[model samples]
Target chain A: GGIITQTPKFLIGQEGQKLTLKCQQNFNHDTMYWYRQDSGKGLRLIYYSITENDLQKGDLSEGYDASREKKSSFSLTVTSAQKNEMAVFLCASSIWDNYAEQFFGPGTRLTVL
Target chain B: GDQVEQSPSALSLHEGTSSALRCNFTTTTRSVQWFRQNSRGSLINLFYLASGTKENGRLKSAFDSKELYSTLHIRDAQLEDSGTYFCAAGNNAGAKLTFGGGTRLTVRP
Candidate 1:
């Protein structure tokens, strides 16, 4: 079985700082996704990539930028972090099928001070 | 707007008890997926159903595309099952998934 790995299990950033989170998958999946989860809320999609160098915005992509430089890796950048913001960012990968299940990595917890 | 709504935002169950979680979609969806998020914030995929029912271990999940709803049943719950459970729906032939608010399950011994 393949695994999805996310870097920096915890992150602490100052206001207006730009923080980047990285994800890597060994599943050789064709689709990768970025999602944000706040306390007491559901996961909201930020961005997704169908292939290398392809990007698509999601419902919550206004303050985030994503890059898929290679097929096995996807990265998300938080542009100008909001003060007192606390959330967990998750990375997931799935095969290119309508019924394929998306596997997720252990999230990166972001805390802005 | 296409949405997924989950019932019983929070639930508490004693070990060995059984319960069910429900997800209702605002529109017709192609498929549904269930995930369990552990305390450390890792999401583990449980089930992905296009239709009918699927069972794995002590968990059983059913999806009715015609009714725009899904259900997840846990039998003889264990303490290790304490976590947040979420259901996501896919409307089209893409990778986008709309997630429900999640049901927080606390299984106490």
Candidate 2:
């Protein structure tokens, strides 16, 4: 039973400011994902990494950048925050298999002013 | 475009009642996963099904790849079950999960 940990439970950023969120997983999984959740909506995938230093863009990756410097950690950077933007960013990890279930972290709530 | 559609965007149930959530995929999917997001924004995985059904405690989930759909049944619902529920469908390969809009469940005592 491993856990996924995300840093900074809450974040407040100004428009055009850059912010970064970090995630770590102890599951030793080969895949990590970043997703964005808006109020009253489902999650949209931003980026995913299959292995260390490997990155793949998802449906919503245009405004974000992701880095997988190590196998156990994945990070996301918001290039330029949008004014009045509010969303929760979630990090998840899964094994390499096709049927593996993803384990998610608590999430980081981002609010842009 | 391949998409996942979930029904009953919101639901209100009294404690002890039972209800089900459903997800339909536009294309055939290899598997389906169910997750519940708590009030504090933590997603708890409930089930992952490649085919047939899997049961855990009071929750049971079923996935039918041929039918391109899945269902989640909650029996004797409790107040703690109140949260947003999401279903994601994965392609035949690794981790191409597309999520549904989610159902907001409010279980009142």
Candidate 3:
């Protein structure tokens, strides 16, 4: 069994600051995803990568950028933090198969002050 | 756009009781996944199904692609089971999972 690791379990940044979250997976999955979950709500996908150097925008990708330089790692950058924003960013990975289950990391909680 | 709608935004159950949560899809879904978010904010994958039903211990899940719905049943609930559950639907391979609003389940003794 492989695990997904996300850095900086908690983050605090100023308004308009750029914060980056990193994720790495050893499952060798071909697909990686970034999702944001607001308090008391479900997750909304921000970006996903199907392969190395490939990216796909999701419903909530407007304020975020993603990079997938290595097959085992994916990173997300908050282009500009919004004031008083609080959310948890989750990273997940899965194989290319339609039936494959996506495994998630512990998540990074971000707070913009 | 494809959407996943989960019913009963919140639920309460007693120990040893049984309950079920459901998800209804707006479009044809090729697969469905169920996850439970623990208190520490970690998502635990419970079930992944393309079709039919699957049982593991006290939890059972069913997915009907033709019917565009899925259900998760919990038998003999426990305190550890109190958490937020989410169901995600996918139409294509390797990308784009539409998640439901989530069902918060609290198992009280």
Candidate 4:
């Protein structure tokens, strides 16, 4: 069984600061996704990639930028952190089709001060 | 306008009890997936159903595209079953999923 690993389990950022979160998967899946989850709420998709160097925007993609540098890694960048914001960012990977189950990372908790 | 409506925001159960969680989709969904997020915030995939029902161990899940609903049933609950459960639906083959609000389950001894 392959695992998805996310860097920086916790993050603290100031207003207007830029922060980046990274994800890696060894499942050799062709699809990767980024999602945001607020406290006590469901997850909203931000971006997804079908293949290396390919990107697609999701419902919550406006405030974020994503990069699929290669097949095994996907990264998300918060352009400008919002003040007093708190959320968790999750990464997932799937095997080239929607019918397959997606495996997720533990998540990175972001706190903006 | 959320695409998925999940019921029972929270639940508490004894170790030997049983219960079920559900998700209703607002649109036509091509597939449904169930996941349980543990205390450490790691999501573990439970089931992925395009249609019909699937069972594994003490858990069973069913999805009906025509009915636009899905259910996950857990019998003989254990302390390890305490976690937040979420159901996600996808309308197309794009692999983008709309997640339910989640049901936080607390199993007590």
Candidate 5:
């Protein structure tokens, strides 16, 4: 019954700029994830964290960096925004070892100018 | 080839009508999850099934572990049912879930 909150619902940045997105979950879940979704497409996992200060790279982790500073927060940074990379970034969390279900946050839309 | 494929990339139906969306996996899947992405970009988890079927209100979902497919049936659809539906599947021992291209549903009034 907890919520995941992502800041800056909308973000506009220039190509090559480094943009950071923040996510916070109060669900006390042990696993957190970051995913990207193109318009009319499925979600792609970018990065995930198993616990505090732990990070794992996903299929699309290149050009992206993630950090779990605390158990409650996970952050994703676009190393160099690509003009064609405008998409929504979604944050999700799940209980440890519960890969079956993950709760998602209201996504953050990013547009590279 | 896609590890996961969702059929009827888009669908439109009148309110009170019914329709079903399907997801086919390339290999056996241990679990499947269904989600609805609202227009405002919030994803709501609809169902998570390891096997068999589950129902909540007007939505029913079933996962076929052996057939590598899953189905979501919406009955007596309502206007609020309009959204992008997605299915994600994971193998028996993996934590990663391969996602299928979503199905866009528009329930007309």
Candidate 6:
């Protein structure tokens, strides 16, 4: 049994502001991922880390950046916020690189004013 | 880029009813996984299939590697089953998963 904790269940930001989201997992998983979900849309990959200090860009990584400072934690940063932007940021971790099941965080809902 | 598509973007069913959700892949995939998003915004893994079908309780899933598709079936629906369901395919080249738009399901009393 393991837990994936995401800080700040809700976040609010102003246009052009930078926002950061944090995720930590005690599973000691080797892979971590960041995904963004817009209203009425599917989840899009933003970033993924195979191991500590390793970063890979996803389809939606143009305006986002990610860091895996340690094996247990991964963070996502929004370079600039868009007005009225509302979405949920989801973090997931997997124990293996194969099509293994991923454990997800509770998620952080973000609103850009 | 690899692609995934879910059928019936939204669904509603009465208690005791049965339904199936499908995910189609644009390319041959290494594996597939199913998930259900709860009201609290937590994605819970329902099934992980490398190939063939697997069942647990009222849920069943099947993955076709060559055909590039997956299916999830729910029997005797319950209110607690209401929410969005997603299926993601893992690519063999790098093991990166590409997710579908998801299916929003509602089970009514």
What's the number of clashes in each of the models? 0, 0, 0, 0, 0, 0
Q: Which scores higher on lDDT, 5 or 6?
A: 5
lDDT of 6 by residue, A1-113 (tens): 89999988999999999999999999989999998988777777889999999998887899898999999999999999999999999999998666767778999999998
- In candidate 3, position B71 carries an lDDT of 100
Ordered from best to worst DockQ, the candidate numbers read 4, 1, 2, 3, 5, 6
Sort candidate 2 into its docking category: medium
Query: What is the alpha-carbon interface RMSD for each candidate?
Result: 1.3, 1.4, 1.6, 1.2, 1.7, 1.6
DockQ, every prediction: 0.75, 0.72, 0.69, 0.80, 0.68, 0.67
The TM-score between candidate 4 and the true structure equals: 0.97
Alpha-carbon runs more than 4 Å astray in model 6: none
Write one digit per residue (lDDT tens) for candidate 1, span B26-51. Answer: 88799999999988988989999989
For model 5, the superposed segments whose C-alpha errors exceed 4 Å read none
Q: Note the chain A TM-score of all models in turn.
A: 0.97, 0.98, 0.97, 0.98, 0.97, 0.96
lDDT of 3 by residue, B48-94 (tens): 99899999999999999988999999999999999999999988634
Q: Which candidate comes out best when scored by lDDT?
A: 4
Give lDDT per model, in order. 0.93, 0.92, 0.93, 0.94, 0.91, 0.90
Residue-wise lDDT of candidate 6 within B1-109, one digit each (tens)? 5389899899999999999999999887888889898888788989988899999999999998888889999999999999999998887646467889889999999
| Residue lDDT tens for model 2, B2-86 | 4899988999999999999999999878888999999898999999898999999999999989888999999999999999999
Ranking 1 against 5 by lDDT, winner: 1
Candidate 1 DockQ score?
A: 0.75
Per-residue lDDT tens digits for candidate 4, residues A27-91, read 99999999999988889899999999999999899888999999999999999999999999999
Candidate 5 chain B, poorest ten consecutive residues by summed lDDT: B90-99
Worst 10 residues of 6 chain A by lDDT: A95-104
